[model samples]
Target: MRTTLWALPVVLSIGLGTGSLAQQRSVTTVGSVMQLMDAMTIPASNAVFNVGRQPPETDEEWSALALSAVVLAESGNLLLIRDRARDEAAWTEASQAMVEAGAAALGAVEARDVDALLDAGDVVFGSCEACHATYLKRE
Candidate 1:
């Protein structure tokens, strides 16, 4: 019984580890980078930026802001997907900046602070500009 129990745990661990590896290997991009930017990142960042001009008043408004911030933050992860990443070093740095700026926006929204949201918006804009300058093709 003791030996069986120990072996069972080992078997389960190996099975779970294999499943995890499989999931990692299967990670794929669903949308093109432009699609993701247009659908998620741009709108979300716009929401954060607009808060400076028209601060959220109702709970529902605040909740919407929260959702936008979350989408923005998660969009950074989407950019980091292996298929979407343009390069290793600069791409990773830019994506991480997006994540951090989004997080800051989320924090500001939670606090109901318009000024802080504006500051975070600036950071988000700077991150976007930095990445676009390096990667975006103008032609």
Candidate 2:
């Protein structure tokens, strides 16, 4: 019983993060966004890791699709705080690619087209690689 009680919120926070945890966690908006981004990455990593053997995404895969959308939304919101035109423009380009990647995934989930799914992967990769090139710098 105690285990169940403790587990409930943890389970919910997997898909929901703006409630009780927001207060006690000392988490800023930026932290919350980072958490959300982390959530998105898990499924994406799984999908890509299992690329060859996995079934194409489907409407039932809405969980992953939602994760991607949430990440992209946070990215768009970050644009509001960009300190320079170049930064804003770079983020804009990446955000667009993120959107295209997500939209393609959503469409592939509904349509079950492997080709479209592959294309979505490419767009996602392009945005990530491009942004990393400019901001992250290679190790």
Candidate 3:
């Protein structure tokens, strides 16, 4: 059975519009973007990661996992918003990696494939680590 991801279109529209609108508007701060990651992306990634230990058993569980993946993917778009981007090259690369990883997780979740979800979780973890290594400030 094919699963429907309700938020995918919304996320796609936002990502598609970012290039043109990003330069025209400055809506959020990098800190705010990070907060979005902490609140949404990280948890979503955890759900993907946890799939190895406890795979979703029901349709509701699967749908919830799909939502998590959507959140993780959309968070990448949020990071790409010009106002929140840290730099031109590396930041863009890392953000795109995040988007791809999230998308992969979503696909795996839709397929109900445990192994692919785990692989996507690895990509998600790598993207997070790379970005943090490059940009995260320490006191």
Q: Estimate each model's TM-score.
A: 0.82, 0.54, 0.79
Task: For model 1, name the residue pairs that clash.
Answer: none
Ranking by lDDT: 1, 3, 2
> How far is 51's C-alpha from truth in model 1 (Å)?
1.2
What stretches of model 1 exceed 4 Å from their correct place? 1-23
**Number of the predicted model whose lDDT against the real structure is largest:** 1
Per-residue CA lDDT of candidate 2, range 1-139, in tens? Answer: 9999999878788646654343355433443434534655445534632444675456556456445545554453443342321454676687566666666665664566666666666666776676657765557
Better of 1 and 2 by lDDT: 1
Lowest-lDDT window of 10 residues in candidate 1? 19-28
What's the candidate order when arranged by decreasing TM-score? Answer: 1, 3, 2
Clashes of 1: 0
Question: Candidate 2: deviation at residue 31, Å?
Answer: 1.9
* Candidate 3 Cα errors over 4 Å, as ranges: 1-22, 25-31
Q: What is the lDDT of candidate 2?
A: 0.55
lDDT for residue 51 in candidate 2, whole number 0-100: 41
Give the alpha carbon lDDT tens digit for every residue of 47-124 in model 3: 888888999999999999999999998889888886688888888899999999999999999999989999999999
Candidate 1 residue lDDT tens string, 1-139: 9999879978779779786443367787789999999999999999988886889999999999999999999899889877688887888788889999999999998998888899999999988998998999899
